[model samples]
Target: MNKSSLKVVAIGGGTGLSTMLRGIKKYTSDITAIVTVSDNGGGSGILREEMNMVPPGDIRNCLVALANTEPIMKQLLQYRFKEGTLKGQNFGNLFLAALADLSGNFEKAVQVTSNVLAITGKVLPVTLENVQLYATFEDDTCVEGETQIVDYSKAHHKMITNIRLEPRNPKPAEAVIEAIEEAEMILLGPGSLYTSIVPNLLIDEVAQAIRTSRAQKIYIANMMSQPGETTGFTVENHIEELEKYIGVGTIDTVIVNNENIPEEYLKKYMEDGAHMLSFDAQHPIWKLIKRIEAPLVRINHEKEYIRHNQEKLAEYIFDDF
Candidate 1:
């Protein structure tokens, strides 16, 4: 089959999902983003609280990433309001909220929004129902919600024991299942390990589908450890944690950053309890690692902090896949 005919299903949320989608969409039109819906912060949080809807921030990010619009249009979609009363409101998030309201269905809202924006590929919520994430620490302490779990982990400096979706069971969207079954490749994160990647696995059907599918599964590890969530974690620990949630030998390959980060930034991250993801040649999983000397080590636009360079990232993801 030709490259464009290769279907792909990417799972995760936050900037990682968007970053991978921006890259993969360039290779194939058959892209489906199965995003996490556990966010309870920012504009998506406000809308979720008021309307009792699934958090829209992650979904909004995926929409913009897959959008086929010009650079200016992408900028506009990502533009945030910085004024009294409506400060830090993202245009794309609000637009998605409004569409959800109008359609009276979150899934339909995503479909309508993607079509209206002329996005290059399909974007989907990992689950359609309003759901919350809960985590149990290695100490057996329990925490509810993604935000709370991070706060608990930060204060305790413990690894997460397990995570599950509230309500325990949810019907996976038929489209999501179809995409997974039909995909030639499935990409997991470079996102928050506990908050983004693990939550997707918490769903029984989603996990089962992934296990049964024949797609080549690749995990793109994050360059920097997240504070509280993955403090002092190595590239091996990242893979180990993924296995804890998704089962062993689930990842066929891993892509890690090989570039060196500056000491100044490293100090700042360390203060936040973050660590650089170390790739050790002696490690058992080292043979599966594909190191990309990515300049993802630097800041972007002074405000966005760090981001993967789109053009270079796109080329590499396809090259490896």
Candidate 2:
């Protein structure tokens, strides 16, 4: 397929989806990001409570990632207030909130903001309904809200047994379904397994559409395990959990980082109960899915974190897969 003609649909939330977009946009403008709207923390939670709208933080990040606007404009949107009543709130989230109010809909607001930023691709929320993410721990205790669940899991050392939306079986946005149907490739993950990725699949129609779509489904494995989310998770473990929600054989390919991270950075991450996810060639799941291992890792010395090398990752997808 011609690189420019490839229609890619990425699903997930937080920095992972956005980071992937920054690279993918260089090859094709036909991109659609289906973001998770179940965030209930920080600036997003505050905006959701006050404005009675879907969380815009993830949407804002995706827009900025795919944006072709000037550097100053991008910085302006990402700027966060350090003091006053708006302290810790991002300007982009506020901009989306204001646009939602002006347009009388959150999706329309995203479209308007995308146009304003001259974003290469579109970003759509998985569902339009105001939904709450709930998790049931292994201890039989149930928690409401994304932030609370993570905090409880970390503090109590309990694994999440099940996760679902409050208004269960939410109907996905029509645009999200359309995008999945038309996509030539569908990518998931490199984000929080439960909160950022699984929540989107919990939407019945969205999962159904994904399962039935003709696109090549790919799951980008996380470089490092999340503290409370995927602690001690292996590459196959991640795939198993994903299939438990989306159904068996739903994923066609799995991308994992083979490059080793330095001991110093690994030590820092280990202190926080995180570890690099290892890939086992003999894992049974390999029989059902294709594994693409490469040097997809990049370490940020200043921030002291590990992430996928965007350009290398995009190139791998375009040229290899």
Candidate 3:
């Protein structure tokens, strides 16, 4: 299919989803990102508590990613205040918050922001209901908030056993379901396994839509294991954990990074309690899904961080899948 005709739906939140969108938008304008709204941390959590609205942080990131506006406009939205009452708050979050108030709905605010940004594609919240993420540790202790879940896991060294939305079964957004139905390709992850990716699956109809969609379902595996979440998780481990919620065989393809990082950078990540995801040839998940392994990694010299090369990632998806 041609780029303009391909309807692609990407699911997940945070930098990973936005990062992927930057590349995907280069190939197709018919993109829809279904972002998780379960965040309860930082400026987002504060805004949610005070404004009684869904967190806008992730939505803001997605907006900037697909934006075709000037660099100044992008910088303006992303600029965070250094001091004052707005300290630690991002301009984009405030912009979204203001729009939510003016529009009388958070989702509408998102739509308005999308128009203002001149983004290439649409961004849809997974659910409209105000929901929080919760998790139960392997030891059976429960954590109430997304930020707390990460902190507790890291501090206690307990792996998460179960995760779910607080409101249980929030009605999935109509736009989200419709987007999935019309999509030619559906992508998941390259984000936090618990906080970013799985939370979307926890939504009843969202997961159901994915399962029933005729689109080719692809999952971009994280390059590095998250310290507090997937400490020692491998590519297969990530898929297996996801399958627990979405069911086996729902995902048709797995794209993983087989590139090696320099020892210096690897040491830095290891010292921070993270590691490269191991690629196992005999993983049981292989029976259920196709694996596409490649040297998809790109290290940022300035920040000393590693992420999937956006152009390469987009090209691979367009050419191979």
Best by TM-score: 2
Worst 10 residues of 3 by lDDT: 312-321
Candidate 3 lDDT by residue in tens digits, 1-321: 477769999999988999999999988899999999988999999999999998989989999999998999999999999999989999999999999999898888988888888999899989888998889988999999888988887787778888989789899976889999899899998899999999999988888889989999999999998886788788888988888777788899988888899998999998878889997888776877888888888888899998889888888777766
Q: Against the hidden true structure, what lDDT does model 2 obtain?
A: 0.90
Q: RMSD in Å for candidate 2, one decimal?
A: 1.0
**Residue range 78-178, candidate 1, lDDT tens digits:** 88999977799888777777878898888888888788779987888888777888888889998987888888888888877678888787887658888
Candidate 2, residues 1-321, lDDT tens digits: the string is 677878999999998999999999999989999999999999999999989999998889999999998999899999999999999999999999998999899888988988989999799999989999999988899999999988886777678889999799898986899999999899998799999999999988899889999999999999888776677779888898988877899999988898999999999988888889998999788988998888997889999888889999998777654
Angstrom error of the Cα, residue 220, model 3: value is 0.3
For all predicted structures, in order, the TM-scores are 0.91, 0.98, 0.97
Superposed by TM-score, candidate 3 places the C-alpha of residue 35 at a distance from the truth, in angstroms, of 0.3
In model 3, the runs with Cα more than 4 Å from the true position are none
Give the candidates in order of TM-score, highest first: 2, 3, 1
State which candidate, 1 or 2, has the greater TM-score: 2
Look at candidate 1 and give me any clashing residue pairs.
none
Q: Residue 248 of candidate 1: its Cα lDDT?
A: 75
